[model samples]
Target: MALGSLSHGFSDWAPGHAATANHAPPKEMSEEFGRAAEAILIALESLRSSVDLAELQREYLTFIQIILNEGLGSVLRGR
Candidate 1:
């Protein structure tokens, strides 16, 4: 997926600004985040109609861990 252009306000910021000085989230990273968020939402919806509560809970936790540990945490750490 193509990286959407940075918003005008962010794009126009002074180089001294933190948002400008620090690298914006890379394009691939941003796209991955979007995909991961969608996956989590889908998982939640699927779990809602699931019959086995324990299995649902296990899957939900696994999904959450992947999002937090791999997706969000890695992003925050500037991977």
Candidate 2:
């Protein structure tokens, strides 16, 4: 898959916002947050199916592991 496409997918899946340099927003409960979490899971599953580990190079597998462990794992942990 194209890197641009992946990046675009992520941007569309979770759009970022600009925050104040020293101020963090408080968390609030919302159904939208739940939907966003579901969207992330769907994206991850789509990516997993597209990647063929058996045919992937070692470095590429390591990259995938880093994304899964550091990226997705942190989100799942509510960090």
Which 10 residues in a row give candidate 1 its minimum summed lDDT?
A: 1-10
Give per-residue CA lDDT, model 2, range 1-79, as digits (tens): 3421242223112213244323321133223333444454555565655455333323333333333333444478999
Please list the C-alpha lDDT of all candidates, in the order they appear: 0.45, 0.37
The TM-score values for the models, in the order shown, are 0.35, 0.26
Winner by TM-score: 1
Q: Count of backbone clashes for each model?
A: 0, 0
lDDT of 2: 0.37
Residue 33 deviation, candidate 2, in Å?
0.4
lDDT of candidate 2 at residue 69, scale 0 to 100: 39
Task: List ranges where model 2 is wrong by over 4 Å.
Answer: 1-29, 49-79
Best by lDDT: 1
